[model samples]
Target chain A: MSEAALLHNSLMLGAILFAVGMVGMVVRRNMIVMFLCAEMMLQGVSVSLVAWGRFHNDFGGQMLVIFILTVAACEAGLGLALFVVLFHRSGNLDITYWQELREENQAAFMDREVPEEDREKTIWPQLTPSGVEPAANPEEELHRSRV
Target chain B: MLTANEHLIGSAVVAALGLWLMLPPSGERLRALGLVVAASGLGWLMSRMPGLGTWAADAAFWSLAAATSAAAVATVVSRNPVYSALWFALSLLGTAGVFALQGAQFLAVATIVVYAGAIVVTFLFVLMLAQPDGTAYYDRVGWGRVTSLLACACPAVIVGVLAMMLSSSLAGFEAGTATVAELAANVRHEEHVARLGGTLFTDHLVAVELAGTLLLVALVGAVAITAQDRQKTDARKTHGGGASR
Candidate 1:
């Protein structure tokens, strides 16, 4: 097949992937999921770039993909750290919970108005029971506790 | 008339249906049906286009496209955050495959290593840490489904129109052609990694250095933010006697 046809096909695939990611970003509520969708969109753009580079017989597109990878890694690290802090404050991963950053006197449109009863409940992580319990025998306990 | 607008209409409808299926209102049965319809529509649209490249390459393209689109839709539609993350990884893998098919071996490997290996692990760690026990209410109940759908549809239509316009404009232009010997020589010269590295170190050196600085700054910022949070928690423990909880 001609290079033009191949480029067109790859571009089409990239466009579809990008649109899917866009929909995910708009519709998903979890902050991490939204971030992942953003990365997906980046991947789609990288694919198109590489395809275009091959069509033109240039390496510039591939070089740009490398830069995109670097930026994506940086984004993930910083975004995840911020997300962890946000979770600690609100005890949830919901994006709507982070309304404090909104402009002063701006009415929050995304905030969910949960009833007082539902708001009172805290969902703490439950530790699953695992590993061996400490042996009660004194001599055996001393041997087990050697670490 | 149908031939001209087939792909645009088909892709738009498929994407819109997929988005509809992902919305909170759709039940399991409807979502499943939507998935099937959307996949079929995408397949039909792909089939309408004339086959490009060798048979092997064409087969690979179609399968990778299917995998990429399916996984992308799954990432959006899955209710469980962990599952959504896993689907995202699968989608990334499919995208890497597409890059490989496009003769970007270096980029394919880099994408797999950076996105599938590192970034995905980071996302999973955050997902695990952020959610306490079970799925959160927001995961089950997406906000503003109709509004989001409308917003997304506008862009999809715009993209479809743009793609159609681009294809029509480029129809008369033929790609640069080379003899069989010249093609072989070009392939040998375009040693994917070497050319990429040459371009990066020569023409784009300043951009590369700036990217490195950006990464360093982001690292320090992340560390500072997390460390400050820890200090605040420790001070609160001392001053409030842990009663604030």
Candidate 2:
């Protein structure tokens, strides 16, 4: 393919990838999924950078992508650490647990409108037991609820 | 040309709609319908692409893009965080394939090693800690009805505007951009890494050093942050919170 056509095609594909990531970031409540979306966005940017480098026949774009990869590694280390701490504090990984960090003017996200799924309690799967059930410990129940 | 542009724009919107439907809290039947909708939308978009001037290469490119995009979509919609991480890994591999096909051998391998090897593994570790069983109530119900609609709208509009702007700028793209003519020497496939390394050390040596330092700092920071909380959790556990599932 011609250099220009290759550049255009690569860039268009990158843009599409970036848009998918943006939608994921906006819609997903899971902290891990949100982080994955951020990485996806970075992936999109990497694709564009490589394409640009190839088009110019220069190493600058690829070099920058290398740096981005490094930064992403650092980000993953720190972000996962943060998630672990936060999960420990709240016993859940819901982003709403930290909604206090939202902008001052923004209305709160929690207790907004309960979705159909959220309204109904989670139904844990059960199987028939051949033996008598052990009495549930309060401490174990607390841990189970947290899980 | 006008009709082509409309198809391009319309396809994007359709795909976004299908993706929104696939988000958490949807029924299995709805998800199936969304799969069809999303597939058709992507098909329309691919039909408009200026293929790589050959059928074989075009097929390869589209296949990679499709795999990558489909995985990304699944990652976004999956309620199970473990599944999301897995799907993201698949997407990363697909992207690496794209990079390899585009003559970026080193970068493709680097992406696979760094992201799939390290990053996804780290995510899975943390995910297992917080959610051993894949599904959680919060994961099941993503957002309230009104907010979900707005969430979908915001990204759709952003993507729509971006597409329109990019398309509009196509005519002026080549003229508006400047190339570094001095660094235009062609490198062979075998020497691609050699040349890339030379350029990195010569032109961007300081940046390389800075990146190393930044990584070290992040390492220290993550360790310290997690360690500080460990003592507190341990103390709490000792106080009759010794519950293990």
Candidate 3:
């Protein structure tokens, strides 16, 4: 195959892999699965980058793939740590279990009952409107108070 | 348009349908059928594409692509997290193969070592620690298969169309007329790793430094988060007064 054809084929494969990752991210509820899918997407992008570099006769794309590898490693580490912590708090890795972080007015999607022990671990702070309203006229309020 | 372009569109549609079938929440019987269908569809699509220069190279590319996509599908559809991780390793390996085929031997090796070796090990460790049992509730159900399929299809179609368009437009360019063997020879003749090193140290030094710093920060953050979680658990143990569970 010609270089352009190779590049085109690789690009198409990368795009397809990326789409698969997107679908996986959307469908899977497991945090680990979601993280893996994201990595897959990165892999797809990396493929295209290398292909482009080869096509253009430049090493830039290869260098960028290296950086992508570094970032992916870091992301995986942090993501796994977060998953561990979330699992500890909730006793499960179901992403839906952490819906308390969603906007206040939105109805909660987490229908599963949390164990009493786990519930104590998850201390979701109540959002309350609390600060005192500023006076319409601070000087007038001060004078009126003095009077 | 050209016959090749028409085939590409047809292949994309078939592959999309295959993917739609392979997503989870299906019955065991249907899932098996979906796997076969998806695999065949992808394989057929790949075979239909214009061959790379040498028959051997083309075969290698097709096999690697098939393996990568198949393993990826398995990774998402597997009910067991361990199996998913293993499948992900296979997928990563296939991706590395694709990388090597693209003249990125260094990146391919790095991907194998970093992802398959380190990252996958870490994930497996977490999986074992978090869920000692076989399966979890979230693994089996709760996936909005149809909705996710629809969402994924939109981007797939758009990307396919765009790639086709770009390739078609660039068809007249003579810059990429080199055959696969010549391309391979060019890549082989160059000291890619040394050149990459030079590029890193000269052109992308700051970015390299930033990436290093980012890795350091991420490591520290991960350690801190895990440590804090441990402390919290210890505190709860003390507060609860003798294993409340």
lDDT of each: 0.76, 0.81, 0.78
Candidate 2: which stretches are off by over 4 Å?
A101-111, A114-147, B168-184, B187-190, B234-245
**Tens digits of per-residue lDDT for model 1, B210-236:** 999999999999999999988888999
Query: Per-residue lDDT for A1-147 in model 3, tens only?
Result: 467767878887888788788878887878888898899889889888988888866778888899999999999999999998998778888787776777869876664543122345337789898999776987787769654
Candidate 2 similarity to native, TM-score: 0.85
Q: Compose the digit string of candidate 2's lDDT tens values, residues A80-117.
A: 99998888887888887677667889976666554446
**Clash pairs of candidate 1?**
none
Docking class of 3: acceptable
- Model 1's lDDT to the true fold? 0.76
**Considering TM-score, where higher is better, how would the candidates rank from best to worst?**
2, 1, 3
lDDT winner among the candidates?
2
Per-candidate TM vs. native? Answer: 0.85, 0.85, 0.83
What's the lDDT for residue B4 in model 3? 68
